[model samples]
Target: MQSPLRHGRAALGTTIATGALAALSQAPERASRLFRHRFPTVAVTGMTGVGKTRLADRLSRRASAEGTQDVGSAVMERRTRRDPRMRGYRFRVVPGENAATRLGALDEVFHDEPVDGVLHVVAYGHATPRRTAGTSGAGAATREEQLAAELEDWSITAHRIAGMAVRRDRPTWLVIAVTKADLFADDIDAAVDYYSPGSGSPFADKLDELRALAGGAKLSIDVLPVCAQGGGRKSSMPEKAATELLNRLELRLAQLSGHV
Candidate 1:
């Protein structure tokens, strides 16, 4: 079935990059400066099943109606067709996992490559355990405990990345994308509407706490709600996630140019 909503430009390829450049070209000074360096790289990372692979598949224009399988540690590059100078923009997707491996992967990105941004993809659904027989306790307690654990995991990821950003000589931006928002559409007016304080979702409260943690570490950070998969009951689409990611690339590239 055809989607009713028109996808905003497909996956930041030539046409989209050209359009982005056109917008930046309006300010010739910035455009000229920004194009002087090789394109920046952003890494998509998070816990397993948080939708990192799906996000990468959609961004790479490889998404299908059903879904995409997990591809570990994939590297894809994009360059503006009009100008070779704006070349080598890359997205290196490191498979999502818990704190044990997330930190190691992040450490590599920071030390091994000159990464301009990091996309920390997390899912709201992680808080809700899958239904099964012979459950351990009341559903609410289970959910609450699940959310708390998720928060701890996310905080560890954020703390490690923020620590790297603070100590690294070069500057980097961290864009936190809360994925799987569509699954909870009824509860949230927007992606994060349910994540707000007092919303009773530990995920929301923890997200708020993450910001303070970032500030304390002095890392540039921003968070957005995204449905990488379509916006239906358990639907998956990457249009919004792709658009937001592209926007972040443009913004981060420009910022990095000044410091370069």
Candidate 2:
């Protein structure tokens, strides 16, 4: 018969040996984790209503659609596959205030994180029309003068935005969003008469202005007309623009991942 002390000692010895084997097996994993602690991220900066959130969601969905798997937190991701889902750049949605706040936020996020690229959106108009083309209560005779002021302001701001981007190290692709197409459409009749009276539509006039603004910025700006909300009895006309924006975003991601 074995003594109780001897039996207890043997049991304790077996437990210790098992723990040692477990620790030995996990040593490589710990080393691998240390290696994975270094990964790059993409910093996305845009205005509050410029569809940044929508783009991020679409990007995630598109990444998964490309048949990417095996994304480990502390494990090495083989960016070799150009998989946006698991690649060199991760996304950090930097929040911003109004237009100026947007630039500020971009600076702060880039300074503190790993940023490979930036997605910036610049759009037009606010809640109000700024000016209207009319008789102007007989006081302001020159309606054209009022319109000129509005356009000049837009042009000035547009240039300022572009300059700020240059200072911030602009991204591979800068998307210029043309928001509020529907609002312009509301003025379609008036606009068609004012700009394109012969036969062209109001949107035709809008596109020209958008193109002009984009050219001013010196960015290969892709115009996206989106209506997150809609007017009564009218469906949005720029639905195609939304698709184009999404497609462009995916292509940009692919390019960054080195897939394209």
Candidate 3:
């Protein structure tokens, strides 16, 4: 099925073209409530070297079903996007202790309210553990220890929120986002050339690296490939990918609630 965002957008364009704006205006919220009954929460998470922030930014706009502004490296602004379909439901994309506080704030904001769901964005700039001789290597004693550390971080976030507020019977999703696959892929290419010449190319080794870390997360996750840096520029395919993810999420809610 075509996404409501795309179809509705086309419908909206036709409505305006056919002078039906007056009709749509009378039923403004109708278009927004594509999945009104769902309290669906998605914790967009990944390692520190992944693209959490970018996914959050893109997904936020999809949640709101509106075009959002450009958010990239040149800027370090805190941002939020609220859903009109489910009023007071919003996604917070900022970092730090403020993120925890914002979660609680949203809980209070929607304390007595029904929700479509929650989307948690974790880790913006992160990478897989490189199998290096230095601090960034793969394995416990090598370079990528940071990646392991991040896995724990993501788990903590999951347990802290999903474990507490969500139910075991309910679907609590964790999107194990991998950012900078291009860079990682590139690095792999370089590595194969430098370290294991004639052994294998980096492209051949890319998925193996991704799989290793994701497996270590020990969490059932939707491993979404992402690239957040152009560092402060617009994403290539990620924005579209983000929209599709939101649609899947919407579908998940419907399946669970039988809203359809």
Candidate 4:
């Protein structure tokens, strides 16, 4: 019933409004891309039973609230996560049960995208047992033996990462996340010092080797203690420690991204 001029004006107005809405919807994404640094991709890696998956789940906002379930050997594929606190950053978890799978996961990550950093998780003699009954040498290893084996695994992983960095000719950041601090809550300082670089620990020696392998490639390394499941399983770490850990992690990620 409307006149042709009025109908045309109405149509034009509708078009203009829709275009404006579309632009407004896209503005956030555009602004993010413009102001944010390149997406920082980090790989969470360590020997099996070292709480890598749990730590990843705890940091990621998208992870289920029910908690992460245990996996056999290692996760079949790398799981990616994004923390709300770490905007424009991605954390990828790679399996590390054995040399083949560990190296393969790292290769897959490098092939898929350039990694900005790595979180090498360690438990400092409190990692869950990897073997069960009926397996040869199962339960025979003492805690000291287990820790030694894990340190050996760390050496291998570090060497592999250094090789990858040298090949890519890119600077890499490594954070040794000493997980399960709750187990040794009484002597947390000793636990941290044991893994700290230049502490004269075996782990420190391996870190020196990693640096040597990295050669001209810039490698920044840091050691941090974390209790991923604070308040769970009679955890000695208080909730405050968990909060502080997250804050420190956020600050470290920000620093790596040059946001600090």
Candidate 5:
């Protein structure tokens, strides 16, 4: 029979040997973790009532719900055959243009953790018709003039956000989402033509003004219409718009990941 002291010493030695083996086995995993990179964070910023929260929820594939003034967070994930696991980006839904909130949010983003992109949302319905010289005079404003004026007014917020992104030390890609597309689905093509460059229209001039505001920032900008409403409606317009936004987002992510 073994003495109790001898048995205790043998047990201690076995425990030490097992721990050493475990540590050796985990060394490669620790090294791999050190080299692993995390997906970029995308910050969503827009004026109040622009459906920023709704868009975040939709992008995360969640059911649409009421939006809050407070900042919201969500994760957007995609699975690839090579990884066989879902990879994702963090989405931070920031509050609207309150100076304090906006500044605080940017401060956190810049100092704590930098974001890869900005999903700057602009609401179309908020663009109220602008009073025109023609209306105050002998003539009526043309539909094109009215639309252009409204868009220009609504564009100020988007341009401000874009300019901020451009001025950041590491300029982030900008995705301008013209949300609430369902309201004008019937005239989507007209809106697109009006917003596109070289359309020889005043609205086109406004778009140019926005691009100029970026001012040599090496950042990519894309504008697309979006509808946060769930797909099940008579017009499948919402589904189409959401899909387009997702495709654009994927392209931006690829660029960030150096896969493009």
Candidate 6:
């Protein structure tokens, strides 16, 4: 017994309410999409036990609870409460121990779908037992030999990245994170100088070659000294370094994305 006008008004109100509810339901997804568009994926790569995950944990303000080393790969999608602007970084961490996993991760991040940037981590003289094992199963390798092997690993990783850049025909932003700076706190400057570009070391030479291999594409490289776990149990160096690194990383990403 309702009038036509009243019926139409009721139907229209119902439609509007339904639409409002639908939009409200989709707000979170829409926000997620927007956040992803702003903050894209970044690959955190390096040799095993170099503190890549620890650094990511620190940057994302997540507790470093896992004592067991990462074996495969993981994507950290949580937004950091400490730096909201640094939120939403899809930090894909791949294992650096196994050759199969390392190559697979590199291909996933570089060959399959290239990420925004790469953080190639290194810990000076922090050789793992496996890495230091003698080729003939004789004994542990000498410290100098271990250091050489680490540099060789860095070379291989850098070359792979350069190859990917060439294939993608795009600029690449590479940050060489010299982690475990706390181990050499008394001579931090020397440590930084050792790994820095133009230091005349083999590492620097390899970096030069990497840049050359990039051809016309821009290769933005940075060497950062970091202590992902701080100098000691009570040191605040990790927090400070994490903050500085995040700030610099934001700028680097902005530059890479042409948002600068």
**Who wins the lDDT comparison?**
4
For model 5, the stretches where C-alpha displacement exceeds 4 angstroms are: 1-37, 64-86, 97-99, 110-113, 126-171, 193-217, 231-233, 236-260
TM-scores, each model vs. reference: 0.55, 0.38, 0.39, 0.74, 0.55, 0.69
Write the residue-wise lDDT of candidate 4 on 1-260 in tens digits: 99999999999999999999999999998976654344667788787778787787666644534534344345434444444544555677887677576667777665555577888888888777766646754344577987898898887777668767787755788888888887888887888888877889998888888888886348888888887766744557777887687668767867877766
Residue 142 local lDDT, model 2: 44
Q: Name the lDDT value of residue 60 in candidate 4.
A: 62
Kindly report which residue stretches of model 4 are placed more than 4 angstroms away from their true locations once superposed.
1-37, 64-73, 76-86, 110-112, 133-140, 232-235
Better of 3 and 5 by TM-score: 5
Candidate 4 lowest-lDDT run of ten = 67-76
Model 1 CA deviation exceeding 4 Å by range: 1-38, 64-88, 98-103, 126-146, 169-171, 189-218, 231-260
lDDT of candidate 4 at residue 7, scale 0 to 100: 98
Query: Model 2: how far is 67 from its true place, Å?
Result: 31
Q: Which candidate is the best by TM-score?
A: 4
Write the residue-wise lDDT of candidate 2 on 32-130 in tens digits: 554333333545443333334434444544333231211111111112222444443455555423345444544544443324444443223332222
Candidate 3 lDDT, tens digit per residue, 130-193?
Answer: 2433554343333345444554554444444433333233433334344444444334233323
Candidates sorted on lDDT, descending: 4, 6, 5, 1, 2, 3
The residue-level lDDT of candidate 5 at 156 comes to 53
What are the lDDT scores of the predictions, listed in order?
A: 0.55, 0.43, 0.40, 0.74, 0.58, 0.68
Give the per-residue lDDT of model 1 (tens digit) for 1-260. 43544343344366779888888777887764465355556677665556676665555455434534432233332312122443544566664543445556666665565366777776665533332347654234354455555576666666666655656665566666766665654543554554454455656566556556555344555556665555433344445544654455445545643422
TM-score quality measure for candidate 6? 0.69
Estimate candidate 2's RMSD in Å: 15.6
Q: For candidate 5, list the clashing residue pairs, or say none.
A: none
